[model samples]
Target: MGTKTPTEADILRPIKNTSTTYLALVAIAGLAFVLFLIGWSYQLAEGMIVTGLSDWGSGGGVTWGVYIGAFIWWVGIAHGGIILSAAVRLLGMDRYMPVARLAEMLTIAGLSAAGFYIVVHLGRPDRMVTSVVGHYHITVHASPLVWDVTVITAYFVLTATYLGLTLRYDVTRLRDQLPDRFEPIYKGLTIGYTEREDAIVQRMVWWLALAIIIMAPLLLHGGVIPWLFAVLPTYPTWYGGVQGPQFLTIALTSAISGVILLSFAFRRGYDWDHIITDDVFRGLLLWLGFFCLLFLWLQLQQNVTGLFKPPVDVGHAAEGRLGHPVYLTAMSLVFLVLSYIFAQAIRPALFTKKRAAVAALMVLTATLLEKILFVVEGFFHPTFDIYGATPGTYFPSWIEIASITGTVGMVSLFFLTVAKVVPVVELHAIEHLQGDDHE
Candidate 1:
């Protein structure tokens, strides 16, 4: 028999067939969710005392722990999804069409996890709900916290709508091939589908991509998030204009890393090596290398400038970061990985998907550590340093650790569930690219 061409049905196989591995993963995620609930409940019942955070006024201590660190990490990861999607859509990078929807979906999932962290960070979630809902204008306008919430909410809605709109075409195109059980979902997603709607979605998505590309870098990551840290002159390390670009760079790096891992999973799981392609990974890895360089350079800008003159507070903070073994080790590891990735870029023969994945993974770990250090150290050596308080010690409580675990589970669960309902790969993009190939 001639080589069988992969069809829509072939792409939909994951949704139709539930492998044992999938069930096991879902079950484990469910357990983590339960543990997360337990952790949050403990915080609610006991109080903030249960966490490693301490009141700053009484002297010194890390007010934010791993939870906030994880919060920043999750939000940063969310940035990549829409960015990758927007880039592909706006730039007409058809080579990446297969992974665009995956990137968008990852953005939605990452935002969900980030949002969940916000709720978990609140000792009393119900009060925050009432407070925000009841006094939206007063609170939202007045506080950076509220601004973060507002922008994140807006970004989530925009990304979700962007995903939903584009989804209409794919779901409608593959409707007949999908299992009957998914008919209702297909109906809901593709309500009022028409050939004209195709052009309409493309136009809308193009504008949406443009808007997100502008808003995400300027408003969300670079704008509000960095302001949250940079505005506090009390913290020498954080209080600077550099915060915006720094946060944006790390967010892109982590987000690209996330996309790499997700793409690898689907490509391997669904036998999509041809569609996903080595070229896709190669292109993404190059971008990853760029961000990695940017991340390191930004760190240099922040550190070298501070160390050049070395004011008391700046010198103190620098000593804390540079002198610490963990910080040194993480930075060294990131340098090594960045070097390897650059080498691969220079010598294409040196590049392999496995090495790219490994580099991405290391970057994720290194960045996560860097974020935690940034948060904890800023508080550890406050600009005021009022209480004669020394930089405080912090080890995440069990609750915090469990919550992080739960957030990871939540992201995975979100992707896995959505994959079953919709095609993980974009069908229309596939048709377009396949047609071009045939021609």
Candidate 2:
């Protein structure tokens, strides 16, 4: 009767196959264990060197392959959460509350996934502190990744605090009536009566807008789009006028797209179609379409200039870190544009649920490919005698896999655990969503 809000029935209640959120949370805990085991095994059996990354002949050592891929993957995921929270809070949409918790939860999970193992991925794995603060000083102009890490850490703390506050609020609502075992927990969280309606509204707005402003550049910083250009044998692309911003665009596109996909998925899980409806998704798709066209134009402009450069003289372009013919021909340009059209355009206004899901999946797949090609494929530059040779292939060690699994699992668990106690969707918020759906 009360819109899936965690009622006494959640504990006193029995339902089919348990809550999806509960199962997901257990899965998360399992992943966390796997991650710990992986790290432990790596430390015991092979030692640090087995990580496959080393300060070899390359100028610096950083783990590529799965580590980098997962980092980007999780960052994209976190971006979705942050963007969603911003949307709801900034717009004052009540309907978004259900999935808003998930957004925040996923942000905590995905970011944690990336941050935890990056150190393991480091070549000089032990001196991580020295690298961040000492050797690799944070400079706004020099390297955005440094700032990226800093911003991400700060962002994570805020997300955690916000989510915790929300759960605590729910706990206080039920503490007296809750089982005696759980009563103290809620009491501990109250921290002297607070969380007035005005306070919640003001805080949410401030956090939503402020975070959006911070996140745009933060996404770019973590994206390392310019550095990927450095992977070009020539330094030109890295130094190019457009590459940095392009990377930022990619991050923004990927982030918002993720938000749409996740929103739809969660809605489907609960049969919220009456509330969420296709219209919300349609609006999101149109926005994605706009970004696609913008990105396509950028690619068209940059490539056209490259093609027109004189053949013999353009040899210097290689030295300037411009993309080689091989890299350029790779699928990013084609796939990036196509993914947008297929995912955002026809599918939204026309397709059935099944068809839309497939399209969403395609968007995710193509998006990952684009980021990977931009990161790994672009970063693959041979040195000295290895000149003109293709880049080496690398795989993620088990530790990395476990770490990622742990990240995903932990987040899933957090959602489930929270769902058992807190309200996952806003009953009041559902009215906001009704505008788009047919009753």
Candidate 3:
């Protein structure tokens, strides 16, 4: 007999199944999250001194360190995740349907992590409510930080609402088989939901997807986040117009890499090889290579132009940006990964699941390191150096390290917990696949 077509039960197995392995993973994640909270409490007690972060050009210290770097990394991942989902919906790319919700879940987790970093960076978390949220007088034009908060908040809500609205359709369809305990939740989700309601939902979701696709590349990363750095004429490296596109390209690269990793983990745990097939990996890898190339090109654009006839500040900054050992290593890794990806594309036999996964990991690491370097270097060497030409030193403190680990753990815990309740893979998408298979 030919391979059996997977049914709804197969997709829902993760929801019903219980295993010691699953519990162990959840326990680990919970522990990490708790540990992170403890670290934060310590930081709160001792004050921001416990962190390497300090005022810019003051006390020979750079104001942004791991916290701001992490913020950028997570936000990049969040931007990329939702963009993937939006593209899938808008383009009718059913080939990627199996991974859509997974990507969407990643967006929520990434955004949450980003928000957590912002809170941790604030040092006085209460002031977020008192200073920003409480005061209505702050205009978007007032500060780049305020602009970042505004757009990030908006993006989070829009993505969360998009996820919630889409889940209603699945909840309604699976209402009968879903656990009785979840009946109330399902009812709340499916209230007034009918088969005919899907048409209305699809239309609404399509428009929302359109809006996000526009907002992500144009407004979020390309607009506000980059503006925070790019608009500063004092920061020679960051003052250029290229930061927006550079950030967006790297964001897409990191986002694709994250999705690939999540897809691999879920596939291994749930035995989803058939649904999340080799083609999915191949397609995503191609996109990763495309972004990798764009990122490399942009790096060259920034470096080459900055090096030529550069002002004193730009020349000084370029030396650190282009000549740093870590930066050089990351750029080399990008080139190797991109070359490997292209080689595999030309000769299909060279490609393997493991190879693609490794390439994705390389890209994620390189992008993250690059982002951290950008933040630290930009702060260290300002346009008007108060500390002469020498930049301050920064290494993440234990508190910062713990917070990073804890945020990662929280993201894992979220997905693990959600998998037990909602089907991580979409049933409706699978139904469509089945129909096409039969035809």
In model 2, the Cα lDDT at residue 147 comes to 56
Worst 10 residues of 2 by lDDT: 7-16
Give every collision pair in model 3.
Answer: none
Which runs in model 2 stand beyond 4 Å of their true positions?
1-40, 43-51, 55-63, 91-98, 123-125, 130-145, 161-189, 195-197, 200-204, 218-241, 310-349, 382-410, 426-439
Worst 10 residues of 1 by lDDT: 1-10
Cα lDDT for residue 341, candidate 3: 93
- Model 1's TM-score against the true structure: 0.95
**lDDT agreement of model 3 with the native:** 0.86
lDDT of 1 by residue, 1-439 (tens): 1133446766787788888888998999889988888888888899988885765556445778787788888889898778988999999888788889888988888888888877877777886768777788799777888899989999999998999998898887777777788788889988888988788788999999999999986888888988889898878878899989989988998898889988888877777776777898988888888888888888888779777877888777877777777677667767887898778878889988788788888988888888887888788776677777466677778888888788888888888898888888888767865676676
Q: Which candidate is the best by lDDT?
A: 3
Clashes of each: 1, 17, 0
Q: 421 in model 2: Cα distance from truth in Å? A: 4.2
lDDT of 2 at 389: 44
What's model 2's lDDT at 36? Answer: 62
Q: Estimate, for each residue in 1-439, the C-alpha lDDT of model 3 and write its tens digit.
A: 1155657887888899878899999999999999989989988898888786775565777788878887898899999999999999999888888899998899899999999888888999997888778774665558888888999999999998888889998888887888998777778777887788789888998999999999987889778899889999998878989999999998999999989988888888877877788889999999999999999999999888889988888988998888887789889889999999999999999998888888888987788788888888898778888667678877778877787779889999989988988888888777876876687
Candidate lDDT (C-alpha), each:
0.83, 0.54, 0.86
Error of 3 at 355 (Å): 2.1
What would the per-residue lDDT of candidate 2 be over residues 340-383, giving only the tens digit for each residue?
55754655555454544544455555555555444543344423
